[model samples]
Target chain A: QQQVKQSPQSLIVQKGGIPIINCAYENTAFDYFPWYQQFPGKGPALLIAIRPDVSEKKEGRFTISFNKSAKQFSLHIMDSQPGDSATYFCAANPNNTDKLIFGTGTRLQVFP
Target chain B: IAGITQAPTSQILAAGRRMTLRCTQDMRHNAMYWYRQDLGLGLRLIHYSNTAGTTGKGEVPDGYSVSRANTDDFPLTLASAVPSQTSVYFCASSDSSTGFDTQYFGPGTRLTVL
Candidate 1:
């Protein structure tokens, strides 16, 4: 119930391409979902997040699509840039909890 | 730094050796966490403290311990390191006052136990 499975262990795309990374969880108690972006040698930073209450949320060039019924969520990068090449993580947590269960991670590489 | 910071950016230790990885945050967030990132195993929480004086165990708490002396610092200690403990460790902080789930992470400490 604590696992958040992420797909496409690694992904590669050209500039301006769209890369979608998917994550699915087995626990329905998870209410908050957040996506983090990490560059090589840097800590993962909050790129964007979404709640189960919403079907989708967009920020700048990143978007999170949530499927509450399917217990899945995904991160999509629009107009991918070389700078977007990094590892992305999707995490989830139950309400009123401080611990977040993170997916293995998706390594994204965008080439120019 | 304006956010969280970790010490000894990278370290290599002999098996059974003791090691301590430091983490400090200037945000003064109410909650702090320690996680180990391993390939194919995502980030697993090792320990967490909701406040300065209280602490709790997470998914993989064995072989590791943590202390939150004050809101600004949370350190993770390895009593006796093992080869399996080799991985990247991250320290994160979040404000518990709000229901938001945002956790600010530190640069991370890369530990390799041989």
Candidate 2:
């Protein structure tokens, strides 16, 4: 079974607007949630990550908001730009584990 | 750094054939992983090795196999090629000594089976 579920197969946002992608996991054992960004033909790269111990984590224009009790998390892209358009994936990791459970994905398109 | 490198950028095989996808890392990472990426399934781990000579099966390991012969190499093998096995394969490595850390992925190898 897929442990993590992501919403909005695709998203479109105007430049300078905020774009959000939501995800939820069934396993409460997950301790780390990381969001990845992938460009066409490229592997996904870490955009931002948040541990369940914290409510949120922000770096540059990317922010990860995690709700441990709700078994949910989201990635918010602030001031969306054309270059920021890419596929976003949400993943979960259990403590001391090296493997990650990933969500389907959300393709973001920011219009100029 | 060369990071992780997966050989044969892409491959086309027929059913009943045996295929192997090669992965090498220059980072000397103790952890290596093989994952398959599909359109709707995101990325699923097939196999992983925490160190050379030891391997573990991940969520989707039914059709795949992997081996970590040395610190720099981890190869994923398909004993019998099948149509369903066609997908982009990615190899990744991470420096776990710094704590469960970020993984660096390779460009990926696109495979098609007939």
Q: Largest TM-score belongs to which candidate? A: 2
- TM-score of every model? 0.96, 0.97
Q: Candidate 2 — what's its lDDT?
A: 0.90
Worst 10 residues of 1 chain B by lDDT: B96-105
Cα deviation at B48, candidate 2, in Å, is: 0.5
Per-residue alpha-carbon lDDT of model 2 for B1-114, expressed as tens digits? Answer: 888889999999999899999999999999999999999889999999988999999988998888888999999999999999999999999887767888888999999999
Model 1 clash pairs? none
- Candidate 1, B2-110: lDDT as tens digits: 6988999999999999999999999879999999999878889999999999999999999999887788999999999999999999999999877755899999999
Find the 10 residues in a row with the least total lDDT in model 2 chain A. A27-36
lDDT of 2 by residue, A1-112 (tens): 8889999889999999999999999945987788888998888888888888899899998888888788899999899999998999999887878778889999999999
Q: fnat, candidate 2? A: 0.74
Question: Per-residue alpha-carbon lDDT of model 1 for A1-112, expressed as tens digits?
Answer: 3478899899999999999999999844888899999899999998998888899999999999999889999999999999999999999987678778899999999999
Total clashes for model 1: 0
Off by over 4 Å in 1: none
RMSD of 1: 1.2
